[model samples]
Target: MDFIARATAIVGGTMVLLRRMSAPAAQAVGLTPTIPEAKKQGIMTLKMPTAKGWEPGHKPTAAQGLKVNAFASGLAHPRWIEVLPNGDVLVAEALQTERPPTSLMDRVMQATMKRAKAIGVSANRISLWRDPDGDGVAEVRKVFLEGQNQPFGMALVGDTFYVGNTDGIVAFPYEKGATKLTGPGRKLVDFKPGGHWTRSLIVSPDGTKIYAGVGSLSNIGDSGMEAEEGRAAIWELDLATEKARIFASGLRNAVGTAWEPVTGQLWTVVNERDGLGDETPPDYLTSVQDGGFYGWPYCYWGKTVDDRVEQDAELVARAITPDYALGGHTASLGLCWMPEGTLPGFGDGMVIGQHGSWNRSTLSGYKLIFVPFVDGRPSGAPRDILWGFLSEDEKVSYGRPVGVTIGPDGKSLLMADDVGDVIWRVTGA
Candidate 1:
């Protein structure tokens, strides 16, 4: 380790002494949860649990009657998952390459990213996994797509496939059962990059429109409003005209996008801003309305103003409150609706992948949670569906959950464990 790494490790150790909120209290900041007094730290707390590969014959513990099994293993940082109509599982073996640091905090963050095993040469490819025997294990795995940038979200509409790379959206010709793509893709739109880099893609129910979500460049317009142009919002693209427009705005980082089954309303799980104590502004899941602004720099949780940001009286008044809060700094990423009649007791709801947090002393998220819904609205508190990623000592992590989707059979829940490089399948035991 170099000087920056040593300094970061030492500071990380001292953050343990900082006052931290209990998990229950932090979660209470969820739907109508309390917002504690905010306190901006001199140096943002850094308490990420180091990654540790799973031991043999061990796996994550599933909820009550559900069972967890490895569908496929030995992947290269699988971060997103997509299942085809023919039951083939597609996993994006993607990771971010090393970015040059520009500031002291940037250097510290880079050192920590190395410890978390998140920085290196990205695989820049997607692989296809198949379990035709329905035996809960894959029998075939092959490279499906190659020569791509940092790809995350993927969608298939008819015979055309779309991928949301960190910088733009690309489309390729795809066949029903073919395992590989032989044609080069066309770019749809170029996204402005800043802080958050993940882009999630979702096609409209009618298959005519594509929704691409891009996150803000900075926590609160720190790079100036010019740097945030065409960012921190969801863009709707029309296939016929190849035209796009902003669908929603002021969402700091909308990484997960899904549509409610009954009402067809678009919903997203957003990662809120950091450095506001441990429970002031909670990350949330909200129904996206066209031309909506949810307040990123100026305020949060509806009308609660954040004095740290320059007051925007006009913008603050128009900020819409999110529908449901997930938790503070949970880093909620993947969002998918549960198919009805699957996973009894799981209820009609959406499963969220909380990739965990690094800005808190006690740590938050790092598991899969089920958020129940009724009549097109969030009904209750989130329930843990998969956990045990963090060790008992809270110093090591087996992996962190990211993308989530329903299997082609509509009975299994497919999850991506990026750090562990494994795809986990959850079914009713």
Candidate 2:
């Protein structure tokens, strides 16, 4: 509230003063500011905590190292990932797009998180990685798709690898050792296009249905879908028939969604509606149920209202809100849960790629986090899995992490960075 009130006041005051003050009068006011040269701040420097997987969680003083690998390079704004059975990796690359602009959501995120940014992140198409002959590092680079508006999140159901593009879903056949899309790619489904265009994909447990997450192109409820013109919602499609319909709605930006293996619960990571000034509503992780309506463009986290959203008395009762709240504006993305018997120390852990923030005073989220789950349920709060993408000197960072997927090896973790144009592979120490 303090931040919002302050910013709002500044906004109004600035506009009024700009209208009244002439350029000459303002110049005579002695506002001769110029970009200045730098000076070292002495021993005073930003101290970034070491990452969890890259370093120890707790110690007498600081943290310790686990192990890390910058597995491959030469990627161009790589986004989401899908690990092939044979250990190859498919990453989406973002070539020409810039990050999205910060909206009201960034204001709240900046207020809530320690180091939130005031803008949106961007990404692009898929890049392929293969380590044939059992090499530890990736040895192959290939394009899975070209000329995508922007692509992210992908899943493999049997032989087909499905990719989420800005306005549609496409799939190509996969052979264990194949390095490229085997056949001409086929369009699986399409959605109404708007600004929030990074569609994410996942297959149902049975593989008969394809579950796709479509974000609201805009934070408001009025963003009309392109050809399909509609509000925000998750939709399900019959794979064979190419038929689709709404699965859930009122979710502002459900960027990352996954299905829990043990309980068949559908878990989603959300970038909730922003702009109430920091603590009003948080981005969330939840087991989104069918037909559920987590309020968007009006209410958040079960009725904490934002001025941007029109008030409705029944909004709280009608919406199926988030289960657990992450701090506001972390810019949460790419969600995957470790199934039982995989990643031993994790038992069952949820992985989210926090793209980081620029809308706040301080920055937050430049790495991956682990949410512990028990018997198909979240047991406690999120834990940092891998950290330290931003350097200690970076009070603000240029790198933003976008998506994460478990490495196909079953013992490693994979992450995508839109800013860095590379994939980071973390293995247990």
Per-model root-mean-square deviation over C-alphas: 1.6, 11.8
Estimate the TM-score of every prediction.
0.97, 0.76
**Candidate 1 lDDT, 323-390, residue by residue in tens:** 99887888899999995677867789989999998777777888999998889888977899999988
Candidate 2 global TM-score: 0.76
Pick out the ten consecutive residues of candidate 2 with the lowest summed lDDT. 26-35
TM-score of 1: 0.97
lDDT of each: 0.85, 0.62
Best by TM-score: 1
Separately for all candidates shown, the number of backbone clashes (residues 3 or more apart, or on different chains) is 2, 25
lDDT of 2 by residue, 216-278 (tens): 766555433342245467778788787888888877788777778778898888886543333
Model 2 residue 425 lDDT score: 73
**Number of the predicted model whose lDDT against the real structure is largest:** 1
